[model samples]
Target: MKKFSLLSNRAGALFLAPGAILVALFVIIPFFWVIFVSFTNRTLLGRTAVNPDFVGLQNYLALFNPETFFTRGQFGFSLILTTQFVILSALVGQALLGLLLAWLMQAVPKPLKAFTETCVIAAWILPEVVIGFAWFAFLDYDNGTLNGILRSIGLPGADLLLQQPFWVIVFFNTWRGAAFSMMLFNSAFQSIPPSYFQAADVAGATSFQKFRDIALPLIRGHVVTDLILITMWTFNVFTPFILTHGGPSYRTELLSIYTYRVAFKDFEFGKGAAVGVIIMLINLAFALVYLRIARSRNKEAEQ
Candidate 1:
């Protein structure tokens, strides 16, 4: 029996070895490499590219420099913009809209519920390029679907992308990400026993009352999970680049787009790597919070 157990353990290790090696080569190595590069004054089209010097903390210091901190196209500006984007699009828009939709779906007819889910999920699953282009065309001021409709209704068309790029991306991200939150909340609501809601109904509880009291309490864990996940996802989202190109005046430049422009466009590899490290740290914090919440929830469940 001991011999068979040893053989089984060896087989399991063998099965995992390839994947472990791949992760080390790809994920782990690159992670530390980025950290190392951030300490240098590296650029793609410069002498530094050939012989990058370790200018420790200069890249990070430049990002936080007080003179340029609040200026447009600077790291601080992008960080603030990304924070606002995450708050409006993820925490407020996606979480609230998704929760409402999930709650409403609970009382809707089966076919309507299914159709609504399909439509929302379609928005979530569609190719990012296709969705971005479609939205761009729809919102275009001239020869666009939305403009045409507005013109038909005797209303003037507006240049949403150029005029209100930040809001445009906020709305775009909200629409794009709401489906995931909705599905998560829907599952959370499902895990709840129907009898609880039925009891509330017998006690003359209104829909709002039941939702506020019973449903909300029961799904607190899911709500936290959804908020954290969506916040991180929105923070790192680059799809807004397609719609607004972080442009017209850098109005919609989230951290992700700012990083791309810095690293690839400006060819400031070191500064970009610094930005990437900061982003990774922010994401790490979010991940840690999520894990802690999950562990607490698991403990509560076990209790």
Candidate 2:
């Protein structure tokens, strides 16, 4: 018993030590630094003054200030609306599309399976920057592939990008990003014990009943994970805003873009950091909810 305990202790240390060190170095250290910076009045200027004074609560208080550049009161309101749009567009849109694609993959013929899976993976494997640029060209009003097709049909090609910033970003993001959920749901769907599905089918279940009763319950864990990941990614997307430049009067300004404009563009390091910290807190809350849901579902599964 003593020898086994010693061996187990050694093995645990061998694996966990590196991971613990990394977590401390990367996550804990950076988080402490951000907390420290938030309590200071730092600037981006080259003058090396000790301006990041230990001004406690000043930065936090500035969050409520109206005239403050970094914690612009208006950005808070915008963020509320921004979050709503992104959460709806990403979570709902991705799930519906991903499930449809996943189901379709199962129904498609064997010869075509390899081709379609490759296409789905090809989209996911593309670099995000590359995807962003490709979408830019595809959506460009003057020389866009979309407009080109409309013109080929001898119809007036509307300036889709200029006219619909909200839907444009939502559409582009949904189109490019749905593949992650697709792959996840596909894997989850594939892993279910065949008996659950077969039982459902034998019970005179329609396709919808089979999906709702058997498919959704078995894949709920993956669904929760996808929801959390997609929600965080969508809300924090800086790439789309960078490409769109939050144009057409800030129509596409999600939380990330709003924070960027505050911190870097406005040069309010404290206020900017405050916004960042607020966003981090929001993510943390979502993470907690996600874990809770996962735990509850897991407990139910075990029972």
Candidate 3:
């Protein structure tokens, strides 16, 4: 029995040891380091945290400052408000767009469907810098695709990045993000049983009625999943801010960009760490809500 137990222990370790070591090195260690560094006054180029004082709560306090973490001006809001807007706008827009694309793809022919799917996924898989540059050039005032098209229609020239920063950011996010939702909803739609739609048809249900009563309910799980996942992505979106640099007088500044600027640009390591922790907490909340919704759906499925 003792020999058998020793072999079993060795087998278990063989299975678990590699993963455990990876988790410790990549996740656990880095997380603890960030937390530790959050208590100190640090700089970007410094060998160690400057003034290594354990200033408890100071970093957190600075976050609430009217300008430091948020509005760079007198406004009482900035990162939090802008971040919420980005999350909501991107998630809702993408979900709705995905649902439409899913339904359309279902009705379309296979060849066209394949072509569209390829295009959408290609966009999603494209390098961020490539897309970022493409968007930047597209939004440029003098030699932009959009401006050129606008000029053809006799519209005035204006650098969209400067004229409408928020909407431009929102547009860029939605354009790039809708494809993931399309993929998610497309899978959900395909997973739905065809018999139900046939049954609805035999019952003389209208197209809208069938979709409303059957398709939407059946795809609820995918919708919830997409929303949660998209919310997380949109929340952590730094690419938008990086391309825009939270620019045009900080109109496009969001939490992720704000944290990056604080930690890397301003050299306030502790405050940056605080911002990073807060972001993790916000993402965690979204994750919990997603899990709860998924659990509820599972119960319904079982019943």
Candidate 4:
């Protein structure tokens, strides 16, 4: 029996070895490499390309420098813009709208609920390139579908991308991501006992009252999870580049797009690595908070 157990363990190790090696080569090594590069003056062009010098903290300092910190196209500006984008698109738009939709679906007819879910999920599952181009066509100024409709209705067409690029991406991201939150909240709501809502109904509670007093409390953990996940996803989303290319003078340049522009576009590998490190740290903080909340929830469940 002991010999068989040892053989089984060896077999398991053999099965896992390939995956473990791949992870170390792709994920772990690259992670540390980025950190190391951040402490250098590396670039993809010119002198630094081949003989990059160790300029510890200079890249980070330049990112936070007082002279250019708040300037347009700077790191600080992108950070602030990314913060606003996450708050508006993830926290406010996706979470709130998803909660509302989930609540409404509970009282909706089955067919309507299914149809709504299908439509929302379609938005989520469609290819990003397809969705981006579809939106661009809809929002185009001269010959777009939206402008055509507006002209037909005697309403003036507005140049949304050029005029309100930030809000455009916010709306785009909200529409793109709300399906996940909606589905999560829907599942959370389903986990809730019907008796609680029945009791609320017996007490002549309104829809809003039941949602506020009963549903919300039951799904509080799910809400926290949804918010954290969506915030992180929104923070790192680069799909908006397809829509606006972080353009119209950098109005919609979120941190992800900013990093891409710095690293790949400008070939400033060191500075880009610094920005990547900061983003990683921010995501780490979010992950830590999420784990803490999840652990507490598990403890409560156990108790």
Q: Which sections of candidate 1 miss by over 4 Å?
A: 1-7
Q: Cα lDDT of model 1 overall?
A: 0.94
Instruction: For residues 73-142, write the lDDT of model 4, one tens digit per residue.
Output: 9999999999999999999999999998888999999999999999999999999899999999999999
lDDT of 2 by residue, 1-303 (tens): 445464587888988999999999999998877777788777677441255667788877766666643332356555865676676668777767887889778768977977877887787788888888888888788898988999999998878667877787787777767888888998998998888878877889987888888889878788888888888778777777645776667666777887787778877677677778888998898889888988898898899
Candidate 2 differs from the real structure by a C-alpha RMSD in angstroms, to one decimal, of 3.8
TM-score of 3: 0.88
Off by over 4 Å in 4: 1-7
| Pairs clashing within candidate 3 | none
- Cα RMSD (Å) between model 3 and the true structure? 3.0
* TM-score, ranked from best to worst: 4, 1, 3, 2
Query: Candidate 3's residue-wise lDDT over 1-303, tens digit each?
Result: 445464587888988999999999999999988888777767766655545668888777777764543446211245555566566566667778777887889888999999998987887899888888898888888898988999999988788788787787777778788899999888887888899989998999987887799999888778778888988888777777645788867777777777877778888788789878877788889999998998998898899
Q: How many backbone clashes can be found in candidate 4?
A: 0
Cα lDDT listed for each candidate: 0.94, 0.77, 0.79, 0.94
Better of 3 and 4 by lDDT: 4
Arrange candidates, best lDDT first: 4, 1, 3, 2
* CA error at residue 190 for candidate 3, angstroms: 1.6
